[model samples]
Target: METTQHRVVATGHADWAGTSTQYQYIGPDQNKHAERVSWKGHAEAVRRFITDLLKQKPPALTDLSHLAAVGHRVVHGGDYTTAIQITPDVRSRIEQLRTLAPLHNPPSLETLAAAEAELPNLPHIATFDTAFHSTLPPKAYTYPIPMKWTRDWGIRRFGFHGLSHAYCSNQATNMLDRPRDELRLVICHLGHGCSAAAVQGGRCLDTTMGFTPLDGLMMATRSGSIDPGILEYVQNNHGLSAEQVGHSLNHDSGLLGVSEISGDLRQLEEAANDGHELAQLAIGIYVHRIRQAIGALTVTLGGIDALIFTAGVGENSSGIRRLICSDLECLGLELDTEANTACQPDADIATKSSRGRILVIATREDLTMVREIQAIIDLSSQGPGGVPQVTVSKSNDKLPGISNS
Candidate 1:
């Protein structure tokens, strides 16, 4: 008899107050089966979804006990540098970070608590989105601020979408058939939450997101990077509260704010196609920031071996990809128009003669979480030497020999 591996993923909750839960099963038959549900109320919906899934008793998973581990995608880990089995301490730490990731952490906590209540026996692991970027060097992560703020307040860049970045990097490595250590990559993860990372030898050198997800490239609603002076100026001149400024930046800006329309790219694209000026401007700004970041990260990497695009807009929007990649002949990145249009996940859309390859990869953060959880479990079983470890191959002291120009 062949064995079956089952996994369940529950995500969403912050964007629009919804939860998307998925149950997947893979057996030796090579056929994979999955069921998904999108409903309102984050924790309650996840609890009910799981309970209802169990009641149906799918052939792949007959009972809740069959689950080996329950993995969660926690957006902010604060000081947590690695994925760990969730304990009381872990839960408490996650709660404490809620203020930092006010939109994300709370729902994740609620889901974790609900899952624990419903399936108490299984191990629950938190695979932080910030964990993968913990490899950032002091020079890359440090902020040019006061010593008190940097040391005492823990104020520094803690890159987000790390799980996606790691997954994309590994997938790109496989697709390129190159050794992990030999490659230098700049990955652009564009979605509701956008970020970019400069990866060399499977390790993160630097990333765009700083301190929080709102600091990176323009996102669906978030303002991305903006002048700190603007915050004070708005407060002093416009008589806005600090909280209100934060709300406006996080909820009112980005594509929505600029276009004065929907925050969603699809909607913006539709409107832009109809010659909506602000919509067109929104698309232009979004692409401009991404292109600028790619160039900056390329300089950070010394050179770029491969440029990978993943997540919602990066994977699906060929037009956006074209606009982003245009006028980059100097960097030796030439997108194959047809290839880009017909691109699938893990597909290479670069011209055969291009020096730097361009890849469109569909990010699998859930799978990354599952792998990290399994690794931690395996490490734990090998007798207690110390805490479990998640290791990435270290790079050399000197940066790779690639020209800045």
Candidate 2:
């Protein structure tokens, strides 16, 4: 079971024609290497990655034949119940769901097209970010909109950040050394985008995000949950088009909109400490919303036995963590101040007596995708009949924790 982990992420997907890609190779047996290279488009990014990977001394892929399949992380999988092999029809369906996730799905489709072109012989697998939230009951997923809209248009709460939530919840259980069925967990994934999920017995009961990614917690530039009337009002009175209104909420809002400074937390934190009033306000709103979501998710889990934080802000920002946990004692989380600031990830920051443990776990969405791909292959091998199985190579990159064999 050999594996190599590499990330090739594109920037400026808003204008896909001119994009820059940042790639990193973190194979266990190989020293970590990362570089930010400019690629004209998604296709170029894929070409550049494949070329560089093959050129590695102990090449991440000395031969394309040894690579079994390419697993993709699709952010929005409208009604997909599980991972699917990217056949022509499946690809078409994924494309159709683009309107549901205009910002995320378009880039994914571009990436998928590029990867398929480069690895024409290998199976391309898509493991969705929404599949994990399929366990959400009707009460949790139903939108209060008209029945025709939901029934005819397929509009419903299809939460995102499922990969992160799934990864973090599993890691939380491992850290607590508790059985999943016995533990109720609230997992917060805070990064450029943020969301919280409530899981019990390995099933997601509810999540902060709704039909789209922008419905839950306020993100770096996205206005989380805003009054629908406000959109109507602006268009009706201000002569703003729907596109303009949508653009403003999605791009100019959240911390950046409030602070009128920057969206990056590090920047906001510094300005806030320097007595920048708007920066302080932005930080305050961010923490308040997260804390509110945590409380709400805790209730969804019946009560939380553990609260897990993952992703950029959740894992590394101690200041944000302290602020969120300050008044959360009612929810049974007691953060150990010293441990909270000094601890590394996969470590608990809770006091011994706290009823609900506070865990900071680094998310491994890639490993999760690999596992999904492996499961699909393994299932297909069990007497056939499913998305056509791809040949499985016994080796590839080192995925530190997952057993690919």
Clashes of each: 0, 4
lDDT of each: 0.75, 0.76
Give stretches of model 1 more than 4 Å off. Answer: 1-40, 378-405
TM-score for model 2? 0.88
Taking the tens digit of each residue's C-alpha lDDT, what string does model 2 give over 1-405?
132332322111112222444455443254666666654456765665566556755554545565567777778898997888889998899899877776677767777777788889777788888999999999999998999999998888999888778888777778778787888988899988889998998899999888888789988888999889999999999999999988898779998999999888999999999999999999999999999988888878789898888999999999999999997889988999999999798889999999889999998876577667877643332211122222211110111111111
For candidate 2, the C-alpha RMSD (Å) to the true structure equals 6.0
Candidate 1 clashing pairs, residues 3+ apart or interchain: none
Per-model TM values vs. the true structure: 0.85, 0.88
Tens-digit lDDT string for candidate 1 (338-367): 999998887999999999999999987756
